[model samples]
Target: MRLANRVRELRARFRLSQHELAEQIEVSRQTIALIERGDYSPSVVIALKMAQLFKEPVEMIFYLEEEQQ
Candidate 1:
């Protein structure tokens, strides 16, 4: 299974740039970019941080995607 997220959508909703979000979350801009592109899976702490920052639940921001059979 892979993790999927709505980081890009939510970030846009809040009108925050990747750099801005990264600073708010205390991560690198590249990390935010990777998460948005689904290239990297965030840790639980990171997910929670994102959830808190966006005022959203972690489940709403991230979910498990079953692999194709």
Candidate 2:
């Protein structure tokens, strides 16, 4: 399984820069980059907060995708 997120799309939809989004979420810019790149999986609380901030459902923001064999 892979942790996939539409963070870039949500950020763009909110007209928020990476730095600004990171600040709002209380995380580092590199953390945001990691999340965007699927290198990191946020905790459930953080994921819920992000979904709330974007006014979207959690499923819309993050999901688990099957990895290629």
Candidate 3:
């Protein structure tokens, strides 16, 4: 299984640019981009920061999915 997320969608919903979100979440823009692309998984602290900024639960932002074979 692979981890999936709605970071991009929620970021758009909030009308936040990757740079803006990264500032708010105390991460690099590249980190935000990576997370949005599902190329990187964030640590718990970072996840919680994003959840707080987006006013969402961590579970609502990230979840598990079957990996493509």
Q: Local distance difference test, per candidate?
A: 0.95, 0.91, 0.93
Instruction: Judge candidate 2 against the unseen true structure and give its global Cα lDDT, from 0 to 1.
Output: 0.91
After TM-score superposition, the amount by which residue 50's alpha carbon in candidate 1 deviates from its true location, in angstroms, is 0.5
Per-residue lDDT tens digits for candidate 2, residues 1-69, read 888999999999899998999999898999888899888999988798899899999999998899989
For 14-43, candidate 3 gives per-residue lDDT tens digits of 999999999988889999999888999999
Which parts of model 1 have CA positions greater than 4 angstroms off? none
User: Model 1 clash pairs?
Assistant: none
Which candidate tops TM-score? 3
Ranking by lDDT: 1, 3, 2
lDDT of 1 at 14: 99
Q: Comparing candidate 1 with candidate 3, which one achieves the higher lDDT?
A: 1
Report how far residue 3 has shifted in candidate 2, in Å. Answer: 1.1
lDDT of 1 by residue, 1-69 (tens): 988899999999999999999999999999999998899998989999999999999999999899788
Q: Which residues of candidate 3, in runs, are more than 4 Å off?
A: none
Query: In angstroms, what RMSD does candidate 3 have relative to the true structure?
Result: 0.6
List TM-score per model, in order: 0.92, 0.91, 0.96
